[model samples]
Target: MSTTTLPDVRVARDEQIAGALALALAASLAVQNAVVIWVGAPSYADPMTEVLAFHADHRSAVAIAVGLEALNLPLLLGLLVCMVGLVERRGGAGAAWSRLAVAAGAVLSAVFALYAVLWIGVVLAADGLTEPTPLLELVWQMHAGAFALVMPALGTTFVAVALATHAGGLTAPWQRWLGLAGGGLLVVAGTACLPIADGSSLLFVGMPGYAAWLVWLIATGVRLVRSAS
Candidate 1:
């Protein structure tokens, strides 16, 4: 293509990337919420029977949640790529923090996505076996462990994002502060998870903090898309 068209093509690609990232972020949030809210997935402390029953009763929802989470993996990667692209375009010292955020986010994405797959197995296999309690407990423990382990990564990603945005003044002051606070809470939740294998009540901090972060993600995505426009 001619030089004139090259820039236009580049702009279109950038917009598409930004839009996809935004949609992905929104989708990830929506899927998780639907699983918990609509499917009535039990709390971490619930007995194995309850967990099994919940999954059995809501097998379809569980399956869909798993699929959505699997889909989220690519979306997460796309968001990270678009974020890096946006940061690099800004041409600031904060690019380092953005890069770190992207790295941590990638890890966070994998951890969550893997856990979702495990849960899918739990849901599918829960009803078939004659004695599934032990298996359910084991899987639940593994899920809890994965959740705990990934918390630090999510925290780091948020904190790095906060730093990058703060340095670049790319977001509102409150939004940056939300990231900092959410990151700290996630780290604390991880630490709390160590002694409390049943899933610390504090680990529930992830729920609200993550919810708030979802809003931030939505806002960020919108900003990115608008800028591309």
Candidate 2:
């Protein structure tokens, strides 16, 4: 009956939207990682002069980093919206998970955006300022601290997404586990910030956890694409 088939049509439509968004999100994540690495960014503890010098010399790289990070914000929001829609449409407690995911994603996006903005400021002032070392150093520390501190928000997002996917059968069990495990690592990275001063070493968890998260995103995107087809 036409009535009976209506639900199927709607479900298919949701899958198509979710799939497209997921794929875009995956690409954005990959581009961000590539740009960051290509820029040869300095560490959190690196001297302010060293940091400014790097950006000043490699202005183009700085621009690329800023652009890619900013670009990821919208892509991330879109991805979360699509995923939440899919979960809500499936009808259940998954809605709760979806809400949590959105909240966490929003926080993560904001933090990343702030970090990107600081980098933008750094680039803009790199050539102009003679006594910018103190200011630059302060911004550097803030940016690094923000980056490390935001891991928990991202971890929460991952966990909520994993729950939603499990409930909606959106991804495989192993993939869900991968997400959970990655999230746990992020939590560890956040906790590693306890001493604050020694926080740079804690970044080890962030680097590996982020890589894992990216892998999970790629896998999820593949599934979404397959479903759409």
Candidate 3:
């Protein structure tokens, strides 16, 4: 009896940790967006001069946003690993989907890391520069392109995980549909990544989808914690 109870306790603890990580990641992403908005970060379509000025004026805010992203990366990985564990333990039909989710999520995390690094490079290049040099513009462009490319990875992870969770009986039908729809939008945006990197308005297509994902994360985290309790 003691041995059985010990394993149960451990499982519960793991679930709680996973839930917490999900919530933390959502919060971190929300905060990073807030920082970007607060600092009035320029769009890729904005003139190079405007982009340089924004970076120059809001170095501290950009730094904070980057720091949050750094925190978010590990939280994302932790949550993904935990979700995979849950799916494998209870997933019957979902095993394949979970594997796909983990693979896509790993790519998403890697791309996001690259995005963050590119932003860091942009900031460094903009430092002490009165005008936007060609090199600075180039780095900034690379950053924008990296961000645009992240959409596909994010969409794949979102869709795969939603299907896996649903197959494992961890999510409702509505939740699964929501993930599919939202993830689809992101993928659509990814299809036009080249234009988006040039500052195309199509980037907005992924915003709502990403918001849906955040809502899903919050709801899923709550459910996981409740179940553990």
Per TM-score, the best of the predicted structures is 3
lDDT of each: 0.73, 0.76, 0.87
On residues 4-46, what C-alpha lDDT tens digit does candidate 3 reach at each position? 6876887788889888988898888888999898778898889
Show pairs that collide, candidate 1: none
Worst 10 residues of 1 by lDDT: 193-202
Better of 1 and 2 by lDDT: 2
Question: What lDDT does candidate 3 reach at residue 65?
Answer: 92
State the lDDT at 13 in candidate 2: 75
Q: Which lDDT tens digits does candidate 1 get at residues 5-115?
A: 775667556756866576676867687777678767887777777777787778878777777777777777776666666556566758899889889988899889767
Per-candidate TM equals: 0.86, 0.89, 0.95
Model 2 lDDT tens row, 19-103:
7766777787777667767877777666666777787788887777677777778877887888888887777647788789999
What are the root-mean-square deviations of the candidates from the true structure over C-alphas? 3.1, 2.5, 1.7
lDDT for position 112 in model 1: 90
